[model samples]
Target: MCEIFSKILQVPINHIKPIDYVPAAAAVNRPYDCHLSNNQLINLGININCIGFEDWWKNYLNN
Candidate 1:
């Protein structure tokens, strides 16, 4: 997951922390703002329609 985020956001793995939160979508005009797109989520095998972000993430990580 860290690798995927690093690739999409063009940031180093060290820059990504487990406590970070990124909206599923965000305003791209903001300086240094980043978000995860629906397509990217789908490509990662995560259903974009899935609700409960925190719960889903916990389950994903546990799996």
Candidate 2:
């Protein structure tokens, strides 16, 4: 997933960092958070390879 995001962001894969958070898996719900959009990716200099991005982007969305 980091590889995919890194590619879209035009950044080195090693530069991608994951955010660690405890999920409310039992009862209490976690607070809602904003999601990343393609526009934001572009602003950050993403590539949008126009071939794999559509399918690859979904891989991280589930996380």
Candidate 3:
């Protein structure tokens, strides 16, 4: 989820890189996965701003 991390860390999309392992929560501040699906969707022109649970909550509350 580069989009999620970009939103969380306040960084640009290209700044995120794929990792082979999911870092421990303590190290990363939250569990993260390096699935390629999100990247694929982005390449396909699908805007994915809410891929994770926290984003879902934010969207729900905002609505």
Candidate 4:
């Protein structure tokens, strides 16, 4: 997952630190529907747009 993010963002893995509040920021009041084992993998996939983000974000604001 780190590797993929590094490649996509063209940054080194060591430099690609995960944002501490990202999970909490992304999570809503709904139950956490993800499996811990696949969370990183799934997030990486989402980052690469292999999975659409429309359903992921209710009001996605892309800057």
**RMSD per model, one decimal:** 12.9, 12.6, 12.7, 13.4
TM-score of candidate 1 on Cα atoms, chains taken together: 0.23
TM-score of 2: 0.24
Superposing every Cα of model 1 onto the true structure, what RMSD results?
12.9
Per-residue lDDT of candidate 3, residues 1-63 (tens digit): 567656766778875577778667646464577555588888899988757676775677568
Clashes of 2: 0
Better of 1 and 3 by TM-score: 3
lDDT (tens digit, per residue) of candidate 1 on 19-57: 566676853556576776688777899966756655556
Better of 1 and 3 by lDDT: 3
- Which of 2 and 3 is ahead in lDDT? 3
CA lDDT, every model vs. true structure: 0.64, 0.66, 0.69, 0.55
Off by over 4 Å in 4: 3-12, 23-26, 32-63
Model 3 ranges off by over 4 Å:
15-52, 55-63
Q: How many backbone clashes does candidate 3 have?
A: 0
The deviation in Å at residue 24 for candidate 4 is 6.6
Residue runs of model 1 more than 4 Å from their true location after superposition: 1-49
Q: Per-residue CA lDDT of candidate 2, range 1-63, in tens? A: 667666566678665577677566745755789665689778899896664664656655555
List TM-scores for all candidates, in order: 0.23, 0.24, 0.24, 0.24
TM-score, candidate number 3: 0.24
Error of 1 at 49 (Å): 4.4
